[model samples]
Target: MILIDADACPVKTEITEVAIRRNIQAIFVAGSYLRVADHPLIRFFAAGDAFDAADDAIAEVARPGTVTITADILLAQRVIEKGGAALDPRGREFTPASIGDVVATRDLMHELRPGLEGQTGGQGGGPKPYAKADRANFKNALDRVLTRIARG
Candidate 1:
């Protein structure tokens, strides 16, 4: 199963296509209703309008051999701790050896965000714009993970 923290995810269509082609079940968990395409292999779960609701729901459902897609470092950590694989939208895979450093860096960034905002006159910078290359990378990463799981 592929568990997705779907809010703000840019690879939904790509995921659906790949999962369907591979005959894998994909569950997209979101904070509210999202208009997903109709597909037998794809399921959507709305976790309501609460902070981390979708992440929490995904954590509950993900298990060993499950693949989780999320950009939240904390959520990826949780998924990794649960014996599942986690991949960021930008194709970064979160693993036990790397998650700690990632979390610490994320925490440091969060702590410095206010200072950064002040420096930038309250106009904070956002992530780089998503590009076709990112989509291709994500697809490749997903395929590799799925293939490894299938082999095992």
Candidate 2:
């Protein structure tokens, strides 16, 4: 299973394709701004109005061994605490014990680099570079996780 923060996600289509190919169930949690697809394996849940409503929804639904896609350092930490795996669209994975350090470092970066506003998704930057290498890397990671699930 997978939970995706669809509102500001960049690899929505790519993730959907990969999930479909793998026959995995993925629920995309979004706010009112995102228009998500309706599929058997992939569903969308609208959290109405709230800043971290989508995050709450995904965190509530995600379980151990499930993959969560989100760029929010805070939210990823929450998922990690719940024993789920969190991944950024850039393919960075966050674990339960490491989330605290990651969040602390991210906050420190914000303090040190005040003017540096990071951009992962959304229209604030140009189109994301979806290289073939990225696709291959994601595929490999996806397969590795699936293999682990199978092993267990």
Best by TM-score: 1
lDDT of 2 by residue, 1-152 (tens): 87888888877877788788888888888887566557788778888678789988888877787888888888888888887778877777777667888988876665654343564222234437768777666666666666676576
RMSD of each: 2.4, 4.4
Q: What is the lDDT of candidate 2?
A: 0.76
Question: Residue 148 error for model 1, in Å?
Answer: 1.1
| Model 1, position 101: C-alpha lDDT score | 100
Worst 10 residues of 2 by lDDT: 118-127
lDDT of each: 0.90, 0.76
lDDT of 1 by residue, 31-116 (tens): 99987769888999999998889999999977889999999899999999999999999888999999999999877777666655
Off by over 4 Å in 2: 115-132
